[model samples]
Target chain A: MSKDAFSNHPITPEELPQVNSQSFTPLSNTYIKVNLMCRLVFWLMVVSALLIIYWQPWITLHKLLELYLPQVQLAAGGFGLLSSVYGILADKNKGYAIREHDFSYRSGVIFQSVVSQPILRIQHVELKHGPIDRHFGLASLEIFSAGGAMHTFAIPGLPEEKAREIRSYVLTHSDIAAND
Target chain B: MTSYQNQWLKLSPVAIVYFAVQFIKTIGNNLFYLLPAIFVGYNQFSENALIIISGLGALLVFVAISALLKFYFYQYRLSEGRVQIHSGVFQKTHIDLPFERIQNVRFEQPIFYRPTNHVCMLLDTAGSNKLEAKIIALPKNIAESLKQEILAYKTENTHEANDQEPQTNEEQLLNSRSMRDLVIHGLASNRIWIVLGALAPFFNSLSEKFVKGIESFGVDVDALMASSQYAFWQYVLFFFSIAFVVIALMALISILGSVITFYDFKLTRSDDRYIRRNGLFTRHEVVMKLSRLQMIALQQNWLDRALQRVNLKFEQLNANLERQSAGTSGGKIIVPSVTLEEAHNLATETWPNNQLSSINYNPVSKRLAIRNTLIAFWLFVPLAAVLTYFEKTELATASIAAFILSTAFIILSWKRRGYAIDDNFIYLRKGLIGVSYRCFPIHKVQQTTFSQSWFMRRFQLCSVKFVLASGGQTLPFINARIGEELIDSCLYQVEALKKSWM
Candidate 1:
């Protein structure tokens, strides 16, 4: 333990050590398009499922649909539009930076946060591509460390090739013995 | 060695009975929904003994056949430092578990298996996958020998000879809890609420039974109720007696549960591993390597503080998953009801050179007290108003009493919130009702976040959360400068440490 580092009182924020987020490059804007496509597919599936249930002969809900259909439609449309806009805006704030010793990710619009993980501490890296992502030729890279579930973070909307390259690079560079 | 030569081997014959019992239990659980139908049919067909007998016989035969088939198909082989299992009727599955990846191997011998000299062996693996390979009803000698072999292989591969202390030569008795200590632990554990919660579903029936029993005792309950003045006293006496009985029962249950779970508790250190052995009926032995330890928590409730005792709990990797699946209460190694001094000693022993007593704790902002009190007041005032509206003066009085108690509780909790960080470790102490002192190695912190809301910004306060392999620890309403400093230092340490976390 370093005794000299101990202080009776807290230092001012100006005097505190800083981790500069400005050094990290912003994420590619293509992620917003990918997110929109995925959301569209999700909403389409949800609407179709509702329509199928409504059209079913066994369901007597059709009688009440006349009273609620317009309201439900309006609500669904509004939600879809709001989510799309939020997705585009949120994408602008999402960014990740890879450094020699560690990687840092900056996220959130309302309550911004920056999280950094040392490269040696990374347990594993996963490349995930959903149906929509595959169609858009985009992939999300998930990085997991030996800590809590919350320690894991994902960077979405990377080109599939870029995602694969990053995954391979992380796997090769991270401390292999630490994972065991 | 001869057993190892065998390509594949079946479990002991005793496994047939084990499989049959397991099959029956599974069927019973899955067929719970059909219980009503079965009961109704049995009532209607009571006169037809032949039909019932035939049906039961068919089911018995089916169970026997399936158990036999399962036993026949299940085979395990040990080869090339790996244990391989093959099973399944239609879709055959093969699982290969390497000895190097095995985190822990456990052996259990139930009373039924005693005569047969068979034991169940379970191999646990680390990571989120939580894979457990079980070999049911193997010969006790074979299981023991296999466990030794696997452990020997793991030790040899995981640690170098120069870096590792010889196991048997360095074995030391760390601590043991006595029966008296366990009793205090049970009383002070705060598990009475859990016991009461479990019994909540039967509260109505139990109360009804009590009233009926009282009625049978020839008490004029209706006459008592008819007189308003006398009824008040009688009701108070009745409720007091009920509360007394419930508390007594809960105390007895908690004490018994603690005694049973922690009987003859012992923690021993050998080489770089800590071995815990305890339990009354079913003795359990859990071994964890020091390298795999994620956090150590020292806990003391209000009652424990009065008793001058604290519990030291060591959490290893995947401890949460183990607790969830095994349903083992207090799954971590808990040196139950040790004196505060002894708890500190144990913690220092586990993490050498880190004197817990010397670290200075920095308290959170005092403004937390006002915030919490206001929140509690807002939450309770409306309920009190509603009770007053309903003209339940007695209940309203009780609610106000509760309100005052909760306010005091919040203030006490606020007073207890503080955190300290040294070069090697960070210590966080916080909780309500019970105070917990959590210490995590600074280098092991996977992630750190410092966030400040607009309101917090005005006060120069922020909440810092540190993510460890085991879980996350948060220090709320702390000086923003301190939070930022801790985060930066933790990140620096994470990058600097050359040693592996696991």
Candidate 2:
């Protein structure tokens, strides 16, 4: 009932123990969009956005005037630039991240968050391609976490072969019957 | 209509006739309607000539007839591996749903459905949304036999723990309910909803009468406020009079609605799941796995708080959908009349490992109090100004001031509600009299985010939102430090090697 109850007995948030002990089974070789395919796809979304503005000037011009867009061209350019700068700076945040122990990914700007999961949780992995990705022989790898925000993660564009490889690795290690 | 192969399976012919008579009186209320139609057809609005008169009569007759037949043609049988339900009038349907796929089966033999040895049964799971897939009226004996076979099958095939697609769903339906539970829930939980239903007619009349003079269209709340001062206290007294009459008129309607909704509520447990069934003439059954339940929500309002009652709602997973689930909800709730202590016991019993905490002790930020007070003033400014200028009444101004002051007090109280986050749990409380609460295990958190706007940053405040598995808990903006701390706890949960279902 008093304010002191908080500071007097605060709950501590500590780092999880990570050692090879107990009945823990080490998850197999599946980088959560860590492979080259994801990085490539991520680049492709940015490139496509840029390309559309260059190719379809009228729509862009209309959008620019109506103030319908969230951020201005300058702001978009800034966020895009910031994201790229962050990507380059992402290695510091790399660790283990997974949806359902199926596929794990780790990347961060100032702070690193790594998630890992077992193969059973990897309901499905999808490789999506846009016109630009198709032309560039690149694809984006999206890993479905099955539940919550972990349901899907995007690695913009990767080489087709690498995407297929990651998907295969996840499927082999995981035991999710395809609903289809 | 699908021919009831066993035509003798019809619900009591006598009871059916009796209910039909009630139905006819309720729907055929316009028997003299025909006499008026011929007389008034060319005398009034031609645009709605049919719709306002003959069309409505025909529609009511059609609905009443359909209600009668839907009651009449309803029949079922239990075969070797599945059950059959034959219903509908012009268009016919004969379903042969296998026993293995039937998630959980429940039967309701209401006083009426019972007399004919007939019962309404619901066969549900996460698979389909067909209307009949959830609610099907079947012969009581056939329904019992079907349930027995399914239970026997579930017992025989208990091999895999994660048998995602089992040939048979193992959950059971609430078969027994005491009359006391119904009466308690009816009296305790549903008064406000009933009140709103009762006030509908009065609201329509009051809104049109007060507002029509001003905007003459769309609910111009401004006009209504302006009109309120016309008779001063006298006009306001008339409004209360209107409300009183509306309350009386709505009381019966509200009671009937409650009776229909919670007619035969029964809660049953099978294996590791809880199932609930309720509804009078139109029975409904919902089955949920114990582990699949995501979060339990405790809601109290001014009325409930005074009565020491809390409405319990459960947020379930997609896998736990009933045949006729509410409002695109992936959540299932048991809204019973319970005290704070009882609610806590029920919540803990349902989730033993759940790390739940009460509202943490803290003084709210002065800035939060100030901002809310200012916001409340902003909201009522137009009303305040209008009354001050046109009505030139001191009571009006005092009333507005009192409203603003009371709102400020609530804001101050809400700030005191505070928030607390332990390593594996987060708890929040809000509101005045009712004091709602929500708790969750961090590991079950989907994602958590910390966001701040320019204004929030200026106030040195930010919000940390935890997206839990249930879609139930909503994170409130607290002091910035606590928000960050909550996020850290969730992060810790995600990274923990030994994960407990949060």
| lDDT digits (tens) for residues A1-180 of candidate 1 | 223455455545455346653465666767787677778777777666766765668857756785786577667767887887887787887887777667777776656677777778777788888887787788988888777565787777788998898887777774543444
The weakest ten consecutive residues by lDDT in model 1 chain A span A1-10
Deviation (Å) of B59 in candidate 1 = 5.7
What are the per-model DockQ values?
A: 0.38, 0.10
Q: Over 4 Å off in model 2, which ranges?
A: A1-13, A17-123, A130-133, A136-166, A173-180, B1-112, B127-135, B148-156, B160-239, B318-331, B353-426, B431-433, B441-443, B446-464, B476-502
Q: Per-residue lDDT for B401-458 in model 2, tens only?
A: 8766778676756664655656555666666655667776666655454555557666
lDDT assessment of candidate 1: 0.77
**Which stretches in model 1 have alpha-carbon errors above 4 Å?**
A1-17, A33-88, A148-150, A174-180, B1-6, B27-69, B88-93, B114-118, B128-130, B139-142, B158-171, B212-235, B319-322, B325-331, B367-407
Please give the RMSD to the true structure for each candidate, in Å.
5.7, 11.3
lDDT of 1 by residue, B51-147 (tens): 8899989999999998898899999999889989987767787888998888777665555777777878878776744456888878878776787
